[model samples]
Target: MTRFRLRSGVVGVALLALAASSCASDKAGDGGAGTGADGVKHGPGVTDDTITLGLITDLTGPYAPIGKSLSQAAQLYYDEINLGGGICGRQVETLVRDMSYDAQKTAVAYTELEPKVAALPQFLGSTTIASVRDRLEASGPLTLALAWAPSVLGAKPIQMTGTTYAIDVINGVDHLVKDRGLKKGDKIGHVYLEGDYGDDSVAGSKYAADKLGLSVVEQKVKPTDADMSSQVSALKQAGVKAIILSIAPKQTASFVGVAATAGLKVPVLGSNSAFAPQLLATDAGPAFLGDFAVLQAASPLSADLPIMKTIIAGYSDKFPKDGLDNGVMAGYTSAMVVGDALKKACENKDLSRDGIIAAHRSQNAWDGGFGSTMDFTDPAQPPTRKTYLLKPDPKAAGGLTVQKDNFTSDLAAAYPVTAG
Candidate 1:
């Protein structure tokens, strides 16, 4: 695990004080906190009576499908919580700002919304979350939840709900090799986006490959660049038995299609973010048909799981017109965790920021609709290190179905040697 060093005590105190003062107006209740006549509290972006949480997402960028769905899921959870009279007699409000997948724009949005709300519970994009990490840490421990893998490990003041970026890829690859009964020396290929996200996946794949006694033939691509024939050609030349991908939805589908076009027959395994059902429903999806595998940090969306059912039903009921995808599930899970913290915070007192963080850090386990348990007691690290592995449903054609419930066990077994 990577260790993030905290600032000196003096600097840390100054940041904490700044953060406290930012919320001082809310404490003063002078147009700062509490609900107003319209039932909204006005702060940085909050009005009277409501505690506003700001979300920065890519609503109109390459990652819009993910951002939009995630936003809807959080809204659905908020609506359900509010209907039940809210957390500690206060309604939860969400304000979303489109970041367009740009880091700079995301930083601007975060800067704009920081002083207006009681708390910024969750923000969706990885780039956006990373962009605001230092500011968040300096601004007094604002809680941020993100969808990208790198942000969880790289950013401060953000807690991830599942395995870290590198771990997700390592877990996914290990499952593919073990469950599929691949032998030692089997050639594996990786197709990934070429930045931190891709680097993390590549690093994880290398670690898994070393453990499984396999070899890797790697290919890299930009998330926005669609052409993948050249990279697929290289993987095919390597004669890989299985391929792992760490990419967004569009690129995942495109890579699968290109690989298939090059007459490659290897199974294509993917990280969690690549499990979007909508992408699988497309024409290019058949390339991934029975050959695709994914790692999910949460429970599968089966009717047998009450929590999954509730999330799906509640989200569908609340946002009837919006499409629900994996990112939405992630956002819903994030909100559920935040809600749990709020409930814990409000059990004996009002929903204050300190109380919420304390509740979060004190949790032994969380049942936030996800099958994997979340534990945050380790003060030195963020919560959540478990993961679930799934294979594409051969019967359903492109749909992913759970293969193993606690795939993180495999990762844990390999950890002593793999951790950097």
Candidate 2:
């Protein structure tokens, strides 16, 4: 196996300077005001003093830790922005609701927040977001989804910050073949959740397998399924050289632990949501550190980038006791996207729903000082095809270290994102 080290440069300073320029530009005038007196066309959830956004997430479910971290980081970002002078001369206020990871609850939360917010900054859960997307398309507040399945990209109003689940898996498989000695005709097992998240991951694995002359052995499980003893047994019996996991952190802990016990010591690659920092405190931590690597579109909180310093400083000041994780970066990045769009809308003097959507689409090359630059112009495709491969490390920030920075596999770059 080849070791890859983290590299840092002056990119963070450039991104900050650009952000400062954008903030300075906002001083020209409060652009998103109502047409009554300011001659500006304002949208819903916008007042002269405030701009409201929504966050519907899982605060009391299986993904509670990630949800909480994501929401906290968003709040931290907005707080910093508000203190620095606010966007469009208005303070950003977030309306938060916990859906407990249930689709029905998510629908209810969306119904409640749809009328009051200008846009949604963080809507978590793959299935939950899909349930309320029909309502979003008919109405209009542009929404940023925490989930990243390609299937959910059909709605114009909904957008994702990073690449899709399938893209990450494709890159991961490619990495295994190129760096980890995986060869053609070797069997790679995938244990995935049975919804959009897992299905999309499987799609990428299959695509890579076909191109690389490898075979994928799949095992599908529901969100609630945690014990991976059976799955590991099956994969071991199948003689898989590597394994892909597209489930949550709990399943990740279970799978790695079970695999360790079953002597199925193969290279394990996971999706973005697969591993959480909290997992490092468990008995499975060693297994995760040794054999598992996760692919994600965002940089971890411990990254050496200058933007991360800002994010981490703000988060530490606000939530001193909160454990650090990639969720903080994910949440802050999502807020950056929303803030950028709002700034653009304000500049256009049209803060309406349609105006916000138009402003967001204009960001063809958005660099948030994390991961890769994204292109938001095309709704049919993912924002970017690049992903980072990270490994669990107790000494690292967010309990993970970058093994490969902003990587785009040839197979991943060529794979077309198709909506389900």
Candidate 3:
């Protein structure tokens, strides 16, 4: 397995202190250290009574439904925190904005809210974050990344909250070869997005294909690409035995439309981002019934695990009529992880960016009530990631049937890490 290296704890702690000191002027006051001794909060967006977190997302673009679902899920966690008296004697406040998934808009939005929020828990999309990454490091709030791209992960002070797309695909293709009955020399088709997320998945798929002696026929689509006929048509001509799809919601539907029309009879594997339950309600629904599987970052509420039960109840309470989804679960788990870090930082009386980062980095094997756990501290620690394999099941929550739990792929370990 590939390993990541973080600075030593002593060094990391010192850096955190230094970073906090550097950004102290951005805060509202000067009493920001060593406890609630002075009963004043020193960080931007942090006060004795409130800690405001920011969210940048697309609520009107093609991914609008996803954005709304994510926001709702995050709100669920924040509501719980506030109801329970909040962190460090302050209520958690979240300010959300619709960037429409545009990079320029994200930059504009961040500038307007940067000084008012302590951190961002759900800033999304690779392009949007990349546009404002450097600014985030110098003065922006300590944020949790929703995008697991290497670039995003490398952007310090914006750490990843889940497994990266590359690692997730590395493990996913293993399921295809080992468990899904594929052999060496079998043709594999990769239909992916034209971005860091899709490219990483393709890289992982290629890595596994090479290891297993499988051949791959690849196709790419833009984020806004509504039709995938040309891409799917190429895969059909390639005579692929199985497909690895890393496209978005609309693209997934377009692929399904093409696949179903072509009479293709192969199982399609996908990254976590590929599965949008809304597709199941569309005409493409039948195409997903038995032929599709998605690798997920965390198990859904259907596992009936105690933590999942809480998630289901919490989600129902807030949006009683709406169904849960991967987007929602992603938002929930990410917020939970960030919330844990914030609470921990509060314990140390430094609710600044460095405090949050240090608090997150100090722990190992932490689960944050999500059933699955991973270490965020040591640099050399191999990503001990587990990808849940889920197939489409109308009866299941989010229309996905959990096929495997805590499944780690040997191929995932073999794939190289390019972001260290």
Give candidate 2 misplaced runs (Cα > 4 Å). 1-33
Best by lDDT: 2
Candidate 3 lDDT by residue in tens digits, 1-420: 001112346434533332233222333322233334444335767777667777777666545566666777888888888899988888777777778778888888888667777778888887788899889867666676677677776545676766778778778777878888889889899988888889888988888888888988988878778888887788888889899888886678778878888888788887878867767777877888858888777776677677777877888877875667777777887788788888888777678767777787787888866667778784333335678888787677766767887676877765566653
Better of 2 and 3 by lDDT: 2
lDDT of 3 at 241: 86
How high is the CA lDDT of each candidate model?
0.64, 0.81, 0.73
Q: Residue-wise lDDT of candidate 2 within 31-132, one digit each (tens)?
A: 343552344467777766677888888766656667777888888888889999988888787777778789888888888777777888888867888787
Summing lDDT over every window of 10 consecutive residues in candidate 2, give the lowest-scoring window. Answer: 1-10
Query: On TM-score, who's better, 1 or 3?
Result: 3
| Lowest lDDT 10-residue stretch of candidate 1 | 1-10
For residue 277, model 2's alpha carbon misses the true position, in angstroms, by 1.1
Runs off by more than 4 Å, candidate 3? 1-41, 378-384
Q: What is the Cα-based TM-score of model 2?
A: 0.90
Error of 1 at 327 (Å): 2.2
lDDT, candidate 2, residue 360? 95
Per-residue lDDT, model 1, residue 343, is 71
Q: Candidate 2: which pairs clash?
A: none
